[model samples]
Target: MKGIKFDGNHSYDAYQLFLNSYSIGEAEPNTNLVEIPGVDGAVDFTEYFGGVTYKSRILKMQFTFIADRFGLNAAYAKLQNALNGRRVKIVLDDDREYFYTGRVSVGALSPDGQIGEVTLTATCDPYKYKTKVRTATCYGHTVGKGVGTVDSPTVTLIHASVTNTGGAPAVPTFNGDKAFYVTATERHAGGSSDTFLNESESLPSGKDTAISGVEIPAGATQEFGFCCVGEGDLTVTIKLQERSL
Candidate 1:
């Protein structure tokens, strides 16, 4: 047996690359060898359909578990919160969604008792995005005139007792004349007041039309062809913005 010399001073030729039990930078030399490592993770998803284009958001999470005598291989993340990490969902409701899951990644393992970052990621396809447009159409409106000219027309809202019986946001809004729903105030002023007359529920600020609302949800839609008494041309436009989880 050739005597492999153990020189107290690590030899650059071999000691430089020698495997050790613990990380090298310990305040005091720790003989611990079974320490596991560090960790990291990520997820991606895309969505197409329901009138929405594409939106993405990352739900970041941290994994800080040092391996005990057992080993880092035993480290585990339930990922119940977010499997493929969280992305933005347009639907404003409490939902426990099932995300994606990929292979596990360990932290950068240190040779000399150093720790490694274990990273795992779950990627998905456009989870959800949409334009929630809250509105109702009253066809036979008398077609209010310059009322669309930011002139707060004296005409009252079409449906005095009108109620949108749906889910979640039940009472869309019917304040004043016609403000059950919420939108930008510009639509009222900048809109074509010649004859094409219509009003949307004002946003939280009491402004109508200027801003757009989300697309209608996936469910039974309330249909109304005309408002007989004073019929007018009604049009609806929905605008959407990207959001995070």
Candidate 2:
């Protein structure tokens, strides 16, 4: 863990500093650098005219303790052993350059005597990089529209190259190289009868708000979002789960 030469005042070498400064989580040994920002004499190119932005994909992996009761039993112990300390890997497409060697903790455990909904927060490594995000457009076709309550303007759409940007998804797999998995389709206050809506999903895994699906109704901003690292001929189709509502 030593070799690079430093000028002065820098506590550690750039490599060491970089590793400590940014976290890819213990489970993920490392993360793909989206961009270097100011390195290599790279200028600030923020748009299509400036240049193109290709960002590293941020992915999430989840584990659950599906026990019917509280701990102190073989079940709880089994759950602990399953994910108490585990390494997770996020694979990048094409080049095979990916991140790996991270761990999981039971820290998301709920408190005792807490019945019903006991939700614990699972904290993983925050993702950081200096890459660009490519801008792409997905197609959408309505399935169940003009239905539901008059007050509630709901439109169930299959994953039609377009669905949502962010939602409280329990899984962490992408639809393709640039799309996350689509979920239960419902209504959206998307601009008029026929048009595209602007939806924004979470950026990678560590920088802002954690939002479940948006409550599409009056007074809501149409969002803009895309899937994670989806590969191949990316085609999205989201169907409304009748069992849901």
- Winning candidate number (TM-score): 1
- Candidate 2 deviant stretches above 4 angstroms: 1-64, 70-73, 89-102, 112-245
lDDT of 2 by residue, 29-135 (tens): 23233457567744444553532233333233222333344532444454445445654432222212222223444434443442212121234334321111223
lDDT top scorer: 2
Q: Taking the tens digit of each residue's C-alpha lDDT, what string does model 1 give over 92-135?
A: 11221222212222234332244323322222233322223434
TM-score list, all predictions: 0.23, 0.20
Question: What are the RMSDs of all candidates, in order?
Answer: 22.3, 20.2
CA shift of 229, model 2, Å: 40
CA lDDT of each prediction against the hidden true structure: 0.27, 0.29
lDDT of 2 at 123: 44
